[model samples]
Structures are given as structure tokens and as C-alpha cells.
Target: MDVIVSRSGGLAGLWVTWHVHVDEQPDRDDWYLLIRELPWEEPLPVPPEPDRYTYRIRCEPHEATLAERQLTGPWRTLVDRVQERSEPERGRPANGSDRTRPPSSRRPRRGC
Candidate 1:
């Protein structure tokens, strides 16, 4: 299962994104259950704030958004951890950075 989270807007108007591969994660079942438990079928509960952050979550056949104040328990937990993993830790790359991007192709240079 692939979970992609996009967090947009903040004090700085920055947008952050997260992509979590549930299968590769340690608590795959928990993640799956959490995702299923989220209220995806409902419409945006309230009108959005002009500059507040909103989240766009997409995974498999499920997709939804938690905008501004709508960031509740499970959704909050999910995004928090995803962001934590996104921050630079130690001298290495961000935790989930490796799985986020695909490999690029390289061609041989012409003979000089």
C-alpha cells in the first residue's frame, strides 16, 4: 500500500509532502487500519481558512483531505509521524526520502 500525504500552507506558506509505503513500514496493519478508519466519504466539514494548512491524502482507492482545523486524532497522528520521518535525521537523508523518488536514467557521453 502506498500513502501519499501533501501538507500545504502554514505561517510561511510552505507546502510539505510525504509518501509512505505501508508494506515497507513496520506497522503495516496498524497503518492500514488507521487509514480505513478515517472519514473519507464525508465532505469537508467546514469552510477552509484562507492561509491555513490543508492536507491531501491519497492511498490506493482511498483519498481525502483534512483542512486547517479538521486535523483530528488519527489524521493528526498520521501526519505528525509522516512529517517527523520527513525531517533530516543524523547526517543521512530524510527517513522516507529513499522511497519517494524514482531512479533517473543516464546515457553514455559521446567519445571525445
Candidate 2:
């Protein structure tokens, strides 16, 4: 699953691009995701229609639950990936040039 963040087009929010899988079987429905985080002044769009394959979520102060969708992999892997991207690149030699990467790109363990 690739995640792309775009802030061009005079948009006042972040656009997250990734793949979402929803299906009867465990982790079945899969499609690219385009999550837009609009500004506070922007009006919220209509709620997404319920479906087994794809959906949209909006959270106040940017918080929400993904427990059901997270059945695809470990949670820590997801957190670490998000955290690393959100951090400042001050310590690194160059942006996106870290060689000693983590064991996995998934979120980090909650307890760890």
C-alpha cells in the first residue's frame, strides 16, 4: 500500500493516497484511497455511503478508529510509518536518506 500526500492545487488540506480493501473474506476489498483533510473553514462533504469495500472517515482534531480495517496487518507498523513521516528531518543526513531503517515500515508497537 502506497501513501501519497499532495497539498497542491491551492488546496488547504492534505490528500492521503493509499489502498483500501473491504470484502467478505478477511481483508478482501482493495482499492486506492484518497483521503482529504480540509481546512477548518471548509464545509464537510456528505457522508460516504456504507459499503463493504470502501469508506470515508472524518475526525475532529484528526482522530478516528480503524480497528476493523486494521485486520490487514499489525498496528504498530501503521503507527511507526505515520510517525516517521510526521517528524522533522533535522537529525537525518538528508531528507529520506536514512539507511538503518526499522525492521518493518508498519506502525510501531503500542507498548514499545
Candidate 3:
């Protein structure tokens, strides 16, 4: 299974994404356990507060969006683990550069 987590709407208003392939993880079983315990069917919380981060999580067919204030317990655990173990999504580096791709392969700009 594949897991994706994205955080947006923080003070910087930047979108940061992380992705993990569960089958590639050494602790896949532990991830499965945490995933199974999430309240997927429960209603999502109210709209996020201004300038607060919002998280969107997806594990295959199951997905949820939660405000920063609502991330807790198992949800927090899963997100933290994924962020620690996974790579940044393509073209959405937390910094200004694309960490997934090599610097040599980047195209040069047409104009200065």
C-alpha cells in the first residue's frame, strides 16, 4: 500500500508533501497496525483556522483531511512516522529545491 501526507496553509502558505510505500518499509506491520486504528469513517473536523496548517492523509482507498489542531494520538503517530521515513514529493520540496531529483538533471532557464 502507498501512503501520502500533505500539509498546507501554514504561515508560509506552502504545500509540503511526503510519500511512502508501505511494502518497502522494514516495519510494515507496525504501520499497518496504526493505519487500521485510525477513525476513517468518523466525520472530519471543522474548517481549519486561518494560518494554521491542514493535513491531508491517504492510504489507498481511505483518506482524511484534518486541521493541525485535530492531529493527535494515532493520527499524529502515523504522520510522524511517514514523514520521518518517506521522501519529499516531486517538485514540492520543503526547501526551495527539488530534493528528489539531481541538480545535474535540472533544466536551465531560458532567460536571466
- What's the TM-score of every candidate structure? 0.67, 0.17, 0.76
Candidate 1: which stretches are off by over 4 Å? 43-46, 87-112
Query: Relative to the unseen true structure, what is the C-alpha lDDT of residue 105 in candidate 2, on a scale of 0 to 100?
Result: 19
Give the candidate order by descending TM-score: 3, 1, 2
State the lDDT of candidate 2 residue by residue for 9-105, as single tens digits: 1122222322221222242222112122222233334233232211122222332233224323323333333334543212221224332221221
lDDT of each: 0.60, 0.26, 0.71
Which residue pairs collide, candidate 3?
none
Q: How many backbone clashes does candidate 2 have?
A: 12
- Stretches of candidate 2 exceeding 4 Å from the true structure: 1-63, 66-73, 88-112
Q: What is the lDDT of residue 102 in candidate 1?
A: 22
List model 3 lDDT by residue over 11-99, tens digit each.
Answer: 55666778777877899898888889999888466474887877878776787888888899899999999899966653334464322
- CA error at residue 27 for candidate 1, angstroms: 1.4
**Predicted structure 2: lDDT:** 0.26
Residue lDDT tens for model 1, 47-71? 5576687677666577777776888
Which model, 2 or 3, shows the larger lDDT?
3
Q: Is candidate 2 or candidate 3 better by TM-score?
A: 3
